[model samples]
Target: MSTLYVEQPWTSMSLLFRPHYRVEVFDEHDTPLMVVRESSGPGLQRPLRHTGFSGWTSFDLDVVAPHGQPIMHIAKQFGRRPHVRVSTPAGQLIGTIKTHGAWKQSLHDPSGQQLCFFTDIGRIDTGARAKRHGKRVRRDRVQINPQVTEPLRSLATACAVAFDVVRGTGTRHTSSGGVDWPV
Candidate 1:
């Protein structure tokens, strides 16, 4: 079983920039795999349309090779639940990432079958009792289907990273900023 790890470098200075992330992916053995970064230039109009002035601003992310060639493209859709679609440079759909809640997200195939699930490790209960006990925590666990092939597996990994970026699950301040509940 091949496992991938995603980490966002935290620089206190990042707070001054226009919301961008520099994410690094590593293998189980701790070797660097690929680098995923927010597109540095001007934001594209089409993708930005879906991301309103709300706390969540949708944008395009690129999975870059060591030599700086973008290998994959991840774009966030404009709507409730905010589906993030992963594709190749040629625009072929690889898979999509969707969140069920602040702590739970899943990756799906084009047909919408779940291929992987990512859960933020923490006390999901937010009741008075749980809050009084100070049980909040932060970490991530990814569970991927064993039957998925290599390329799709890679895309699923990228989906996990994209999920964190769009949702801002890494920082405590913005953890629940994008949540929208039904009436």
Candidate 2:
């Protein structure tokens, strides 16, 4: 790891109720080191995500290199707290992201040691990326403390996208308080 760090940015846009994401992972430099892609048909998960409980539905997301080499894997787990298990390409568990509530998720290493935390501060409309969607994009790349391990920083950031992959795929957010706040 370098002395300087930049938050790796990830953007997700759903198509026809199917979630798709594009992530640019950065470390040790200002530019991206790799790409994380979630590209797959809904298949059986479609109907399952519709009527089934989230704990009963399963899906997998991957972070891969530009050459299509696997880097990290995310498999959301069945837990009352909405935990997501992150692993290496070889299936070795690396870290788990367990949500404490709607506003925070914590990263735990394989040994059940909590490493760091990422928080959701709601949607942000700061740039063309957000405007491209005609809506605010959820801020996924919360700054990980530089003291944390490199692997943990990357894994936690990549896995953060799972936070927004709505299980029911309907309008989860609606206008409230006459201010259009997300619910």
Candidate 3:
């Protein structure tokens, strides 16, 4: 997976309001896929996002089809582990993304069993991708347990999108000085 959007410089709209995220998803060859758009009714619209460390920064993102049909729901709950839960639009359990620290993240079953591991750059556990393609590319890709299939793939896709959102984490620079939610 690849992230198709980042911050654009000096847009008038961004100058006036809190920046809204519209994260596009793409394939390895750069083909457009689905989109992970930030919530329309973003909770309270704050300056910080819940990065799993601290603060009340929470977010709801919808992975949608090109025609805008809901695919899956990705949400970040309050925690110190940088977890983003993935579920069906109807709220069926899919999985959770749990970060152990700055260097590693793991995909877990709803029952809390580890499925696979991914580093900040790419897969790291046993069957890790042999080599990384690019920085943003690695950030956009998360190794899914091959055992996972079907609509559940949407959950993995959402996981990749979550990594994209938090790619640079506290390091991204925006005109408005916001970290994760860049304009």
Candidate 4:
């Protein structure tokens, strides 16, 4: 029964600069375990700059060990909702992470059994409300099934962090006071 804590830094005023988002994974005692960093690959700057015009964009990130060895890769699919693929360093598919609705996201094995679930505990607004409130009102909580094994657990953790990144939970700054987004 190992537990992992994932943390993403708060970035203010992200529109001006393309920030390299780094997500840190920690152990139960708060010791650092791994670091996942966003990759600034070619053609990424265009979509980031013209966000409104860009219909869909893909991103690739690297998961690195504490000693700086690359262990896994995360690739996001282009779409309105979050969809990510976890792969080995050699590019073999491990599993997938997908957003089912506003509050629920799931990690599934290649065979399609859900290994973990992520639920957002706050209000989810659409249309004008979402534009006005952004992602500030939501808090994400991840639950991994105890039956999952070691390697899959690690992959699930990485997928959850990647989902957070794609969902803008890490980049959006929450305000002290605001109405929750409409359901």
Candidate 5:
């Protein structure tokens, strides 16, 4: 399958259940698909900003799919979660970005990185588009269901670790002091 790298219009602050974030989706050929943007800010911004905080810790991602599928495809067949390791000077441990719980929801970090779960063929934009003609206005676009998995927590965690190692790197960060702080 061909690889597709869609841009997430939303910011990290919006995905943390803290405030509004926006996202836009495109197909494998750079075709516009969907968009999701928030109309308001998360209430914690002012307070956090005042305290010299930017909300969440730092998490970097390097998606390793060839062209059309996520890297976790094979490992996912065995269990619920899949570990994804990123290659960097400072290696990172990325947990499985899978669907969890009974409802099989999409799981991802604030940056819109595909974690344990993966998306199927469909429009994945969460934004609404509007067209105006004279005094009339029309809304276009639809909500695309993201592919997610519902797996055991333990299995998911293990998959995350394995994913990292599979990529020829073995480093995991468990302490949550934030990346900007001094070591």
Candidate 6:
């Protein structure tokens, strides 16, 4: 079976957030065609603190297939819901949006392609707790933005990371290696 390889960039967002992952490239038959590897780095346990709160960094990735196209290209969104479009080297009108929160576009793009993606956490507010017997009261509230980095940049970083992974895995260029995501 033929194989292709992609590189893993040390500074990529996926590496910074996930730091470690298992990648396996499969053939059309769902067989393990080539290049399966795992990685870990120093950023795995690093914590980011802000405004008396601590949260983990994350990166979001989206991959979409254009109408009548065999290959799917990655997409970027501007915000959480009612998403906005971002520019790519190929222009922004691919017209693929995710109905559910979990789905994302994935594609193969050469390096230096300008792209944008979104990232943000939902907000919450808490009031207080009180006791009546002796007149005791406690008041507090905490709102957290779980996102540690910009979504657009994070998505870009994700794309770069995926590209690196695909490149590093070195599973491409082989007739046996293919990209397929079942609908």
Query: Best by lDDT, which number?
Result: 4
lDDT of 3 by residue, 97-129 (tens): 776654556767788787765542234221111
Residue 48 in model 2: shift from native, Å?
A: 5.2
> What are the models' TM-scores?
0.62, 0.59, 0.60, 0.64, 0.25, 0.22
Q: Quantify all predictions' global Cα lDDT against the true fold.
A: 0.53, 0.48, 0.50, 0.54, 0.29, 0.27
Please, what are the lDDT tens digits per residue for candidate 5 over residues 62-143? 2232342322221222122333222222333333444343223343442446543333322222123322232211121222
Cα TM-score of candidate 6: 0.22
Higher-scoring candidate on TM-score, 1 or 3: 1
Q: Order of candidates by lDDT, top first?
A: 4, 1, 3, 2, 5, 6
- Better candidate number, 1 or 2, judged by lDDT: 1
Model 4 Cα RMSD, 1 decimal: 7.9
Which residue pairs clash within candidate 1?
A: none
Compose the digit string of candidate 4's lDDT tens values, residues 1-183: 445556543323442233354566666576777778866642654544334322235667899889988888887755656567788888887887776653466767867677666432112222121111243112233455556675567566665556544453323223212422332
Cα lDDT of model 1 overall? 0.53
Candidate 6, 56-145: lDDT as tens digits: 222122332223222223332222332223234345443322223322332222333333222232221212333323432221121223
- Tell me the alpha-carbon RMSD of every candidate: 8.8, 6.5, 7.8, 7.9, 16.7, 20.5
State in Å the error of residue 57, model 1: 0.8
Cand. 5 TM to true fold: 0.25
Q: Kindly list the per-residue Cα lDDT of model 1 for residues 1-183, writing each as its tens digit.
A: 445555553322322233554566556576766777766532543333223332255557789876787788887643456777888877888877777775566767878787666432111112111111242212133445556674567556665555554453322222344532211
Cα error of candidate 6 at position 105, Å:
12
Off-target runs (Cα >4 Å) in candidate 3 are: 1-19, 28-30, 49-56, 119-152, 164-183
